[model samples]
Target: MDITQDQTLDITSFFCPMTFVHTRLALDRMTSGEKLVLILNDGDARRNVAASAQALGHVIEADESLPGNRARLVIRK
Candidate 1:
């Protein structure tokens, strides 16, 4: 079953290290088992955020492409 997101973090305006920085901050604020939908720009933002979250032992529920150069990432903290 798909877990519902408890919050959203849009880091489309950020890049590289800052992308994961904000993502980690938001995850820190969430309780265990809660989910978050993170919106990011394509390419580096997409790869960086997802990889960083995974490295931290977070679960990635979904990773999909949006219209234009954006991506929708669902993470469970």
Candidate 2:
């Protein structure tokens, strides 16, 4: 349940499809009770990432904005 201590993937520089692609792949590698943190830039990721995660049944643990137009999303698998 504590995701901050688990695996994290930073895809801030990656755009649209690649961001979702990498997120999906990372989530697949985690165990059922495990979690992953995804760092994304502002824009498409805000919409697409969460939508994709919801569709795949992954839990969106936390979503917050960081300084300078970045967002941090914690997801569970």
Candidate 3:
């Protein structure tokens, strides 16, 4: 899919619920079909944030691992 992200959210400093919370807030502010480039830390935050966004009916366009235990999650809201 061609993912054109409209916004970016960096939640690398957060964990768990906060990670998803920030992502959700970013999504909530966007229109349908718009995309977000979410930069998150590895481990729990990356996993849970993607799952939670998907559970809320958003689309996970891409999930790429960056250097230093980080990840970039592209979400369509």
Write one digit per residue (lDDT tens) for candidate 3, span 1-77: 46677998888888888898888888999999999998899888988988888999998989999999999999988
TM-score of 3: 0.93
**What is the total number of backbone clashes in candidate 3?**
0
Model 1 regions lying over 4 Å from their true place: 1-3
Model 1 lDDT per residue over 1-77, tens place = 46577998888988889999899889999999999999899898898888889999999999999998999999998
TM-scores of the candidates in the order shown: 0.93, 0.90, 0.93
The per-prediction CA RMSD against the true structure, in angstroms, equals: 1.6, 2.0, 1.6
By TM-score, the candidates rank as 1, 3, 2
Better structure of 2 and 3 per lDDT:
3
lDDT of each model, Cα atoms only? Answer: 0.90, 0.84, 0.89
Worst 10 residues of 2 by lDDT: 1-10
Which residue pairs in candidate 3 have backbone atoms (N, alpha carbon, C) closer than 3 angstroms, thus clashing?
Answer: none
Better of 1 and 2 by TM-score: 1
Q: Write the per-residue lDDT of candidate 2 for residues 1-77, one digit (tens) a residue.
A: 34553788889888889999999888888898687888789778867998899898988888888888888888878
Output the better candidate (2/3) by TM-score: 3
